[model samples]
Target: MQFCDDCGSLMHADGDEMVCSSCGARVPKDRERAAQFVSTEKQTFDDVIESSEEAADEGLPSTEATCEECGHDRAWYTIKQTASADEPPTRFFKCQECGHRWRGYN
Candidate 1:
C-alpha cells in the first residue's frame, strides 16, 4: 500500500490509480508525478488537530420531533453538511406523541 506523501494517509490502489481519501492526492502509474501532487497539498497535522477542536466546541443537538401516535421519541439530528438555502428558512417536524407532522418556515 502506498501512503499519501501529502497527508501520510493510506492510499488505496483504485484500478488504474492510487487515491488518498484524506488529501485527494492521486498517484498515477508514474511515482514521480504522485510525489509532486502530494507535495502540493497544504494541509498539515496541526490543521487536523485544530479542526477537531473547533468541531468539539460546536456541540451537536438532539432532534426535537416526537411521535404522537406511539408516544415515542422520533427525533434525530443529522450532522451532515448542506448547501446554503436560496429561499426562506424552513423546518420540518414530526411529533412523537401522535406521529403528526408539520412544517414551519421563517
Candidate 2:
C-alpha cells in the first residue's frame, strides 16, 4: 500500500525496501512497518463472486433499446459520469439476450 514520494507510483515490497514501479526510487522499510505490509491471507473464489456481484446488472433498470448484434429490443442500462463534471453522464447499455455492450453520450 506504500507509494513513491517522488513519482507517486505504487511501490512493491522488496527485500528490506519498497521499490517504486514507475520511478527507480527506493525507500527503506523498518521492521514494524514491513510486517504491517505483509499479507498472509489467501484469496478464494467466494471473495471474487462477492465483489463481482456489486458490478452485475441484475439490479439495473431495463429499457427498449435495440441491440445491434442480436436485434433484441430490450437492454439493461447504467449511467456513469465518464466526462468532466460540467458535461453530462454517459449511458452504458447491455443487451439482455446476447450480452452485447455499447455506450451513449448525453
Candidate 3:
C-alpha cells in the first residue's frame, strides 16, 4: 500500500514497480520490502461457529410494540442507524410469537 510521491494518490503494484492510478507516476518497488508482504500459508475460517436461530434473538431487548401481522402486543426490538447520521435511528421489531419483522422510524 504505497502512495504517489507527487500527487498523493493511491499506488498499485505493477511488475517490478508501483504505479499511481491517478497521476500515472511510477516508483521501483524494493525487492526486500515487497517480499515481506508475501504470504505462504492459506487462510481458512473452519473454526468459526454460526449462531443458531434462538441464539440470534437472545440478546435483543423486548418492548410493547404491536406486531402488524399477528396483533401481538410484545416484540423483540433493536435500534439501528439506517438513515444518515443527522437523522434519528430506526427501531426494528420482531414479533415474539410469529417471528414477523417490522421497522419504525424515529
Query: What overall lDDT, based on C-alpha atoms, would model 1 receive against the true structure?
Result: 0.58
Model 1, stretches more than 4 Å misplaced?
30-106
Across 1-106, the per-residue lDDT of candidate 2 in tens digits comes to 8889999999887777889999979989868777677544444466454346435776789999999999999989999999899999999999988889999887
**Arrange candidates by lDDT, highest first: which order?**
3, 2, 1
TM-score of 3: 0.50
Return the lDDT, model 2, position 33: 74
CA error at residue 72 for candidate 2, angstroms: 4.9
TM-score of each prediction: 0.27, 0.49, 0.50
lDDT of 1 by residue, 1-106 (tens): 4789999998865656888989889977566655565443556576454365434422334365555556666543333223365656555555534435555454
By TM-score, the best candidate is 3
lDDT of 3 by residue, 8-101 (tens): 9988787888899998999999788787664324567677555676667757799998899999999999999988899999999999888999
lDDT of each: 0.58, 0.84, 0.85
Better of 1 and 3 by TM-score: 3
True-vs-predicted CA distance for residue 15, candidate 1, Å: 1.8
